[model samples]
Target: MPDSPYVAMGPRVAIRHTERNDRAEFTRLSRTSAALHHPWLTAPSTDEAFDIFMTKLERDDHEGFLVCLPETGAIAGFINVNSIVRGAFQGGTIGYGAFAPHAGHGYVSEGLGLVLAYAFGPLGLHRIEVNIQPGNEASLALVKRYGFRLEGFSPDYLYIEGAWRDHERYAITSDMFEAQG
Candidate 1:
């Protein structure tokens, strides 16, 4: 709550790297938010799973951030930028979720706007992609709000829960992002 080092701050939320100290609160939120997250994502809810998630952040290609409310420094969601390529690619894929308690309150919209600025500005990325399941209207809307163009569709894209899920790809290049902004 006190002395939290934030990476970015917006009107509705703040962003920061997920630390080992976040295990308890993050896991609790993930567990309780399952009803909202089910069929979409299964966030790391156990100690072992949280350990694995932390390891992903150690790699050069991945980064994990927590979306926290400024009032009390409480986590309301999470966003992960994965498979970052720094050379000619200069691109990454993003995965994100809003905890049930914070869902529909527009925190993701505000927080993700800051994520985009951070990615395109500080991270020096040229393009960012978000893949969403066809049925997930909420995710689709979130990307569209940021002006991510519908790129394509991937059948059996990512394996989630038990089966491979189809995903609709959406992306925004730096030029497109700047033009829209």
Candidate 2:
């Protein structure tokens, strides 16, 4: 791993942009985490899927990042900022998944804080939103820990695992960022 592009760093974790070379390890991690992610999310678990995933990340509207253990450079999880809108909106939505062995270890929380700083500072984003399935307590807790407030609810907001899933929306704005401090 090279020097990280982290805007925020904790003792145990560093967050940085995803690299093309991460395909193998990311796929392996996603595969192993199937049980943990099942009804909630699905990360790219194959080379072909990773290729497509990377292509999307290369676009202006999407950014993908890897959360890694600083010492070992082992990926703990990934976060993506999608459908970024500039001009007046200056906002984006977030999606993330934690790899097995790292899940429930608080690494995701540390990494998310870094991502929020990067988004609000360098990326010039004013707001970030997350839509999570209601039953996904871990994910809800993660966002809540970061001070995102529940905004609203959407019925069949996203299609996941061949079904349209209901989602609870949460968000934090740049104004809210200061309040968190």
Candidate 3:
């Protein structure tokens, strides 16, 4: 068997491409993060959710990484770059969430930094965007701290929990990434 090409964050914490062996932990993490949403989390089942998550993992249009804690071998969070648009626009959107236990410790921020590096450095993605609900103060604060510029407000941009939620669009380009240094 060839070695896994996934990224590592720490002895216990890693940002790795999803693997079949990770299904159970990823399912647990998904269900946990879903609970934190204001609207409540909804999914068919852990197995079904795993299938959906794996579908994203297998696609070239997106990249998904699971944040795992080696001590317990549990998934603590997840990050992904989705809806990649190439050609003159080599960019993608960022989506992520942290499990309840992993929240408030800057885990997501660290994960975001690594994911952004992968997007801009390894993936050659020129721009990355985040669409977050205006009411999600935690998420808003996170993107702001990362120097993402507020682009605009998008109404009914995503369906979360159940209802169509409005989102505030934020973006960071490779130039912005360089400027930050």
Candidate 4:
């Protein structure tokens, strides 16, 4: 296992960079969580696909993080910062999933808060966005809990699960966080 840096830490969970050794557990979680992720998202469930996923994370514009229990280091979920734009924009789109066993336990929510801090602080990112299909209430609630406000709607915004899907755009900026504080 490579040395993984912890992006943020909480009492019960820690958000850390995804390591190559996470393959087996991540695949198992992905396979088991199929029911929960159906139509909404899909995670890599095989070694080959996971390898490809990791390759993408190694790119400059992407980052992958694992949300893990502090004691056992078991993965509770994952979050990806995608298409990071620096320069004047200083933003990124976020994608996340909670493993079935950990769903509804608030791990993903807590972990995401850590991701937000890391993104807005050390990463120097000004804004982060999450695009959710309107029907995915769980996803919408999660972002809303983190103080992401609805920006607008996008028709056929992303191709997912073999078809174009409409999405509601939600976003939060560092300025918003400061205002909340």
Cα lDDT over the full model 1: 0.90
**Candidate 3 wrongly placed segments (more than 4 Å):** 1-13, 40-45, 70-73
Clashing residue pairs for model 2 = none
RMSD of each candidate relative to the true structure: 1.8, 1.6, 2.7, 2.2
Q: Give the TM-score of candidate 4.
A: 0.94
List the candidate 4 regions with Cα displacement exceeding 4 Å. 1-5
lDDT of 2 by residue, 70-178 (tens): 7888899999999999999999999999999999899988898888888999899999999999999999999988889999999999988889999999999988986
Expressed as tens digits, the lDDT of each residue in 115-151 for candidate 3 is 8877898899999999988888888898888799999
Error of 2 at 165 (Å): 0.5
In candidate 2, position 3 carries an lDDT of 57
Provide TM-scores for the models: 0.96, 0.95, 0.87, 0.94
Deviation in Å, model 2, residue 161 alpha carbon = 1.3
Query: Residue by residue across 1-181, what tens digits does model 4's lDDT show?
Result: 1464676898788999887788898999999998999888989999998999999998989889999997888899999999999999999999999998999999999899888888889889999999999999999999988899999999999887899999999999999876776
Over 4 Å off, model 1 = 1-4
Residue-level lDDT for 40 in candidate 2: 100
> How much lDDT does each candidate structure score?
0.90, 0.92, 0.77, 0.91
Candidate 3 vs candidate 4, lDDT winner = 4
Worst 10 residues of 2 by lDDT: 1-10
